[model samples]
Target: MNEVFAIADEVAVFRDGAYIGLQRADSMDGDSLISMMVGRELTQLFPERDKPVGKLLMSVRDLALDGVFEGVSFDLH
Candidate 1:
């Protein structure tokens, strides 16, 4: 997938046979790519009401990769 950033100047993401959006490789990241593919923010994609919270299921802390990935976090039950 990093090759995508190396060779392509732009990428057009899609869903269900429909065009989603056009974006530059330099501007893309794991979070943004997931949002485009899922059609919503990872947080908003799954609401608390969909599942009970406050159980301390799983957590990601201080994840970073210099300029590539930074302060990214998530949780799941």
Candidate 2:
């Protein structure tokens, strides 16, 4: 996880209640960590986007909710 990498100096992996390995957080990336945890190399973590993205369906500029939020802007397709 991002938090784990951010806060941990070293990372230890356990799979099926068995200790796998330990390595420096900076020495590993998410895919490597995941591969160790799952006991296999990850080919694709996410599916490829098949459909082409459509045009923007909505837009919000300078949106605010009083004291909750301010100057928010985004576009959605």
TM-score of each: 0.48, 0.56
lDDT of 1 by residue, 1-77 (tens): 67777888888899999999999878897678778988889899766795546777889987899879898888865
Candidate that scores best on TM-score: 2
Off by over 4 Å in 2: 44-77
Q: Give the TM-score of candidate 1.
A: 0.48
By summed lDDT, the worst window of 10 consecutive residues in model 2 runs over 40-49
State the C-alpha lDDT per candidate: 0.83, 0.93
Backbone Cα, N, C clashes tallied per candidate = 0, 0
lDDT of 2 by residue, 1-77 (tens): 99999999999999999999999999999999999999887876565789998999999999999989999999999
Q: List candidate 1 stretches off by more than 4 Å.
A: 1-3, 44-77
